[model samples]
Target: MKLGELFQEIPMERVHRYAPERSLDLITNESKACRPGALYVAIPGQRVDGHWFLKEVLERGAEAAIVQHIDESLPLCQIEVPNSRRAWSALSAVYYGHPSRGMMVYGITATNGKTTISFMLDSILRGAHHKPGLIGTVKIRLGDELLAAQMTTPEAFVLQRYFREMADHGLDSCVMEVSSSALEQDRAADVAFDVVSFNNFSREHIDQHGSLEAYWQAKASLITQASSKSVAVINLDDARIRTLQGQSAASFLTYGIASKDADLLAVDLQVSGPTVSFTLLIPRPVYLAGVDRTVPAGAWPMKVGSPGQHTVANALACCAMALAGGIKPMDLAPGLLAYGGVERRFEVLYHGPFTILDDHFANQSNIRTTLSSLSQMDYNKLHICYAIRGNRGVIVNRENVAAMAPFFKDLRVGRFIATQTLGEVTEKDVVHDEERAAFLDEAVRCGLAPELIPPLDEAIEAVLDAADSGDLILLAGCQGMDLGAGKILTLLAQRHPEQKAKILWPLNDRVCGQTIPHPPNKKETQQ
Candidate 1:
């Protein structure tokens, strides 16, 4: 494409040296990714400033650089802008041909329920005969292809590329999880959505976001930025989401469980065995702005393959967005029935006499939900295992341990094992002393005993040794527990080789126990 065509969509601050006829090959923020004829964007970051690497990128192959400051001496074309992040976002869409603008893009943000809603919404889109794609913490999907996701929301450049691919694949709609980090960093700055929803919120990522108020601001921006034509589906039960209603210019569609004023209400929620059933009531005088305001007064039996009352709430949000998009309640049954569950949210890994569940519990809300679900299940004995949360800082570690304390007290397990990756982690994942101290202090404060274990291999042995045939083993944590299920199955394969095929676990790209561990770094603070 020519330089003039790329900048045609978004206005530039000032072009220092213009060559509208010049051919452009690619656009990138990272200096290392620059190739011949690439336009490098100097986006300022937390640790390293792209401005400092302008000379390096120019030395390599970058011909034109978009920067906040003008550099006179560099032998390259420079475009100056006030905010490169937003510029980068706009440029990315222009480079890839604004793909999301044509489709019905549904963005969902919250402390939890993001993944579950993504799956539920995807299923709903399919029922409407719309080919859809998904992008979230669990994975990214384009039709039948599931690729491992590096983040909950990828960078703007990558996002535009994925949108282009989805559009080329003939996808008419998309439902994606929008993370607070991505929102704060303007990763999805230029994404124009047809509908946006804010699920429940909680105290999560305070360490990274600096404060709860800041985290909420990051999450609320998605709803606030929507155009007036778009619809904002909100949770009526959550005060945090309710408070942001005035900030949004978009039409509002409210859904809730306990709130009687909700436009879409799910009532009489019951969890039986491994399925959740509820009566979806779209009462008359339903107060949705742009949608059919007066929905037919009726109660429909709704059952989900996923187990939890919370999952039903997630489905309610999906129904709200779908209804706002012009789907009737009667038409929603096919999609809700077709939906199963996302991987690792509350996935059953092993289903023999003993059962194993894999959950990535990063916050108090997530830990509480999983524990509450466990309380409802029929199990003779309950064994809990946690991975040593690393690099999240002391506050999160303390809160997570505080969340698990009640479960430990209720279960009355003799002792639970906590394992670390033994420095088998990157610099961003090293455990800090204060974090471990917080966990230990909270465990002791709650009258629970926890044994610190090293090298996950021995921790699994300890948990299995204490387990009976009907016991439930929960392998839980964030980064440290990614490979926990695979390792447990590997051990089971070694003991009972015939049952290897029967073992069920969350499917991901995490390595097994056989992979060699990274050597310890003296600078790193190992727990």
Candidate 2:
């Protein structure tokens, strides 16, 4: 594509060394990845600014560059823009022929359940016999291919490339998890979403976003950015989500479990073990695109192959997006049933002598919802081995421990064992002293004497040794607990070699964190 074609419709600050007719073969934000005819976008980052790499990228390339700051000294051809990130996304879409525009694109954004909702919707589209792709926290799927995802939402260049590949592979639709950071960075600014959803929100990534209000605004942009021809899936049960009903020009599709005025509702909800069954109340006629007919208003029995009442909200969000996209209601239940759950979102690791569950207990809301769900299940005693969220500030740590304190007190959990995952995490995830103190101090304040275990492997062994038959063992936390489930199952296998097969059944289909030990970095904080 020519320089002018790629920059078409994209607002620019000023153009230097005008190259409207300049042909470009590639575009990249990274300086090292620049090729002969590539356009290097100098994005100012948190630590290292891309503008600093202009000399380097210019050395490797023989073409133009996009910049927020123009340097007149260097002979580098520059296309100045106010926001390099937004420009990169917009230009990437143009370079990729705006692939998302050719396919039905769905986005789900929230502090939690984004992965689950994306998976459920992907399954629903597949069950309806439509080839669907997925981009989420767990993995990225394009046709029969499954690529591991590095983040919740990938960068603009990669995202556009993935969409382009999916379209070329004959994919009819794509479902993705949109993260607040991605929205704030304008990573998904150019995605042409046919349907988008705003699920529940909570205080997460506050440090990265600077404030709760800013975080909310970042997430709220997903729904607000929907085009007039699209649909915005709003969760009416959440007051925050309900406020967005009339905020967008897109057609509204409201769903809820508590609000009676929702266009769709989940009633008679039941969370039994690893499955949540509910009767979905569809009060109005919905067009089923797969069947090419509109189904009349009625209640239909629905089941999500994942646990917790929180999953009911996820299921409803998925149902709303799928239904609005004209998917058959009958296909939804089957798709949700086949989901099986994400890797660490309350995944059941072993259900043998003592049941073991793994969860990404990231924040206060997540920890509360996860423990609250376990409170409903029948377990002799709940043994929670928490991997303290590392590098996430003291506030989040305090809130997380505080959230679990009440559940621990009510569930009669004798000891609250917390681990720093010492060597098992990257430098970014290293637990700070203040964060550790916050968790411990909060637990003590909530009338619980928490046991501090530094090593992740030892923590798992300690919890497993203490847990007895009929008790529930919950390996919890975000990055710190990624290796907890694998370690727990391995120790269980060593303890009972004969029952090893039964104990390790859950590891067979895990999409994420399947690798053991995680090859810890020795530079991480030890204590």
Q: Residue 414's C-alpha lDDT in candidate 1?
A: 50
Clashes of each: 1, 1
Per-candidate local distance difference test? 0.79, 0.83
Q: How do all models score by TM-score?
A: 0.92, 0.92
The TM-score between candidate 1 and the true structure equals 0.92
lDDT tens digits by residue: candidate 2, 175-203: 99999989999999999998899989888
Candidate 1 off by > 4 Å: 285-297, 504-527
TM-score of 2: 0.92
Structure candidate 1, residue pairs in collision? 349-504
Tens-digit lDDT string for candidate 1 (1-527): 77788887777778776667766666778898776667889988777899998888878866688899878887778888888888888888888788998777899998988988888988987877778899887678766666677778988888987897788888888888999999998888878788899988999999899999999889888888878877888998998788876577788888889889887899888876577788889786454454334455688887777777678888888888887776677888788888877666787877887888888887999999988878777777777678878999888988888888877656645548887756566667667777778888888888778888867778877777777878888888887777777778778767888776665334344332224332332212221
